[model samples]
Target: MTVFIMVADVFTGAHVWQETAPRLAAAGSEVHAVQLTGVDAGRPATSASIDLETHIADVIAAIDTVDTASDREIVLVGHGYGIHPVLGAADRRPQRIARVVYLDCGMPQNGVPALATVPDQALRAQLAEWAQRGECEGELVPPARDEWQRWGSTAGISDAALDRLTALAAPQPLGTLLQPLRLTGSVVVVPTTGMLCTRNGVSIDLVQRLVDLGDPMLTALADSQVTFFELPTGHWPMLSCPAGLADALLRAAAGEGRSLRPVGAGVPPAHLRPFPLDVPELPRDRREHVDLYVPDAEGPRPAVVFVHGGPVPAGTRPTPRNWPTLVGYARLAAAEGMVGVTLDHRLHDIADYERAAVDVAAAVELARADPRVDADRVALWFFSGGGLLTADWLTKPPAWLRCLAASYPILAPLPGWGLTGSRFRPARAVAHAGALPVVLLRAGRETPEIAATVEAFVTTAKDCGAHLELVDVPNGHHGFETLDPPEEIRPALHHAMRSVVTHLTS
Candidate 1:
């Protein structure tokens, strides 16, 4: 029989496992849920001063309760921020633990605080500053009941459950988040299992790609002793799909889950590979290294500024202006008697979007000032990750900005990206785009993470009665503009361009 020791997450108590615990107990296994200080409903965390070490002690105690069971197998499962305590206890008592399961959370490294795992740059920065100033000694309030999505993905969770989650949520000890998770590195020998919740922006496919990158920290994830499973629900699987989680946990304890292929098993990500599109080569002038595909007919023509999606590598050659897809779009616009402009903005890292937005805005200002451009009739088309930049324009579109277009774009930050307070979230800002015509090219075959953003934007837009047009490429992939063969994608591509062109010229 397996003995399962569960650790709850931040702002939550052991009750979070109420739905899943019984199932494990009924399977002839022992289940114990650790109730860490500052998060227990009975404890009343009204000014709790707890920290990481406190939780570590709590988990150690939980482990002790089942430690005397000589005939039973012991497994430690950590969900969300609970992984810190889980890992800490496992480190101090490795000999007693058979396997450590990282449940829907990042692997906790030694000497790093749980707060470092926060996905939002703005919120993370503020918290870090507060921690530095000793302000984190106070309790950090949880998000309001209805705003659960802001905390993490709420896919699979119903409103009633959400309301309960909010009502029962505790005021977390900011110190707990601000303190480092110290490990003695003794748990290295412990086998591990991971459950990825895809709807919350993590998937085995994404993990495989990251492992292929050869990042040292992620490389260990490919080891044979580390098994993996995928759950299609969002965060809080115990609440959303408790039964499914129970079965997975049982299979995981039995070592029945899939082992990730070797580190170099997969090729580089599809986006980093060569573009598959074929477009006509055209003579174009590149001022300041930016591509300006000019029409033969006239000057002072309407220019469509093309912004490439990326936190692409800062040094990736053949910058956005030169990519075949951007090149094709620029040439297409030029062919239609309009100027198409493409510039390489410095959006090289996930956290660099804010500065990258500055670069994009500057590029647009420069495009408007160009002597050959008609500043009054310009359209801005963003691609891929660049889709986030649409927020600034949508929020307060200038009279001179005629239209906005995005092709398989990431309108909202992924739940795992830690961007709860990011201004770059276009889905939230799209409602502000009242009369500004917007065109979105959606890839039916898009990754679930990016698709979630589209779903949010579309739903919000419809609710607000925003004038939005969608071009669905039934078989298109996320980067289909460059990845799909021109023949298969041309019809949708042409329709999107025509819509933008009509908005620009009309």
Candidate 2:
């Protein structure tokens, strides 16, 4: 087996893998620490012009140089910002790569830049300021020795190793951080492992929660056979805890790590059971399936149709069996004495708003026709992009619909949807909603564009005298309901859920 290690920003492969590579090699595995083009010479010159593509090329070339026969099993290990290039290389040659290991770094996502992946808003702003000042010619220079010192001993790097790393550190190209990643969706099938650093007090459970919450990068990894291990050291575990990092990587490569638990497992409790709904109207090409979580109560209960959001690519389908959040919500609805229905809809790219509306209508009809559901008391629940398809219902809701609820929904027409030929302003629909009750669950830190659209809808609904109720989750972000909510905001999530259920059942 050959283990290819990718170094973090500003540091050479030798500096990053000095201790870890030897341990792996001693254990009878081949080790190759790939050096980026500019950093391979020990330091990047000020005049160097490097970007993400250059680093990706460097990784591919290293793989080619090491795996001449291409018969050996290879594990791609990337630290820090190295994950981006490693992902690009893996997407290019997924057949050759067995597993990708993210070592205390952010996971890579399609079309997301390295700079955008930085979680800290203040730091991103500072970097933007530096870029504007032409610092390092619009590149991000390595942090000074003093700056590294201020990072403190938390990373657990030895003084000698720290000195070597700082001495060898060089400027990284801004283009690498700014450029968006391009992927062909092949990398999603490859096995992934996260060697998380716990110095920031993030646990493996917290990471799993983030994945469950639909954090895009974590979700991508989790969708595959992903595993996680926590390193008690700082972000630079290769430098701080090389022996342990090496062992964890070896175990992950050998398939010794525990697989993530399948979502929506086990029985739905004594009060609820899964009921399959037949939606013959769904396109034959799409996943034609729907599940109804019917309460074990009396007949003719109020029901709610759960529409999972998408444009989930062409190949993948979102289902309650694969997403526990959907099942969880359905269970919650059942617990509240309502028949909960979840259904599969075509991707936004493949199906127009009209087509999705038809699917929703079919699901609603299925619920209405069910012996256990109250046809006149049904409600519609939309999440994320699925909200875009509800324009017609908002404009002229059916007589049987009790209310409409949307969480972190898309209310405007965006690119990639064939919306140029259609008129699909959700605000316009809201303005003509009449007296139909509408509940909107909003995340406080939602993107500016979404916030603006939500604001417009609220204002329009108010002006039109529509029965609109806004539930603002001050501490929440988008997908908070499905994603693990922080302790403080759990109550808010529950309150929002209760509010929606009340609106439907009242």
Candidate 3:
């Protein structure tokens, strides 16, 4: 495997690359570390203040020096701000690059900005300030040796290695910080996991949210042909957990889809289960049908209805990825002797798309009328475009449906919000906000339109006195399954559902 390591801002030059490259080389990977100009190390890059274009050129130059025609495939790995240059370089010479690994960074799609698309203005301002001052010489300047040493050790790094790193580091250029990348090809992401480390102590809840949302973007990229791996480690894992990090990269080069456990394979974590159900058309303008997944049990249980994204007429069903989560809940409910239900509604008929809200409302009525269900504990789990239907269903929902969980849900038909251009406007989602306790989750790395759609729902619903919590999980994409499901992401939805159950039953 030919692994080319791209360092992030303020961590550049031969020193950083030298340390990382040789290790990968020894591990059977032909390695190269890209040193971008602009950030002043001990020398000047070009005396000209560097920009995004310059940084991009710097990456290309490094790649050009490598013998890509050799038997080995080239694996490009970028960390944080390094993604900008790597992406630019890949766009220019995608054919030469086999796998682009984004280390602790979200994989941006075809056209996306480099800056964090976070809505928090204060955070953005802080970042802008950091970018403005982060670079000095042609080389990237790392943090003070002491700070890095502390970071490394905490991340499971060795002291001797830290001393070595101190000697071989350089300053990075600042101009590349604001560059917008146009990624022509897909890139796999290894997102920085754990915690929203504030100036204060760790915010456990915030950190969980970040990890949950951030990890999903990796899945989305994988779906786009860019595979991903969910490594549970903090930022700069290479320093803190070098052995683990190296092994992961090496395994990635070897094309291992899932993480490899150590010698002792522990018992597999408990998984969710459910029996698939098929529902026939009661009556329709034309012959239409529906399928449902009702939890297996001896008695009636609470049901959760899901509305998938896209026009109902486009044909939608609950995905297998979601089934595990739903099954987890169903199992939990069943353990407590409660029922779990997943319903499919009519939207395949073109006429029903516009009437999705009404159609779903009728479905809830059907769920409520079903003798095998407990009407009081029913809830709504809406995803993407289906969010519109969910939001609308909540307007005057059945006596049941005590809670609503919108997974990357769309809130309105506002321009750029997904449903506006679709056959049915999403505004119906907003018109009915005061229905139940709502938990909204948005992908921290989703497209602007999707983010805005989710944001609209949270903002509007919050104002209506609904019990609401908005969690921004890093690495999540539109449907929230950007990459394969990691266990960390699973618990959040389960907790959210359990919270709803507790709130309703209590």
Best-performing candidate as measured by TM-score: 1
In model 3, where is the ten-residue run with the lowest total lDDT?
Answer: 192-201
Model 1 root-mean-square deviation: 4.3
Give the Å error, residue 211, model 3. Answer: 15
Give the C-alpha lDDT of model 2.
0.68
lDDT of 3 by residue, 1-506 (tens): 56554545345453444445657778877766665664535335665577667777877887788776677676767765666777787778777777667665544555544544212233334545655675422323455666552222123346776676666655544455444566655332322221111211122322222222223432232233433454444455555555656666776666654322221134221222222221221211111222234445666667665555543223222332244444443444444444444444544422345566565666666766677777777777776656656644556555566777777765654321212234343334444546457767767766554566566656666665656766656766554443425543555555665665674566
> What TM-score would each prediction reach against the true structure?
0.81, 0.51, 0.44
lDDT by residue (366-441, candidate 2, tens digit) is 7687778888888888887787776888888888887888888878753222243354578678987887888888
C-alpha displacement of 362 in model 2, angstroms?
A: 39
Give residue 19's lDDT in candidate 2 (0 to 100).
82
Weakest lDDT window of 10 consecutive positions for candidate 2: 277-286
* Model 1: lDDT to the true structure: 0.83
Tens-digit lDDT track of model 1 for 1-506? 89999997778888889999999999989999988777786555544578888889889988888857477889999998889999999999998998999999878888888887765566778888887888767777887876667557888987777888888888788888899889888999999999999988777866764565455667788898999999999888999999999999999999878876674455544445543444446687777746788887756999899998876655555466776667888888877778889898888667888888888888888888888999999999999889999999999999999999999999988876767677888998989998999999999999888998899999999999888999999999877854676677889888988898899889
TM-score of 1: 0.81
Candidate 3 lDDT: 0.51
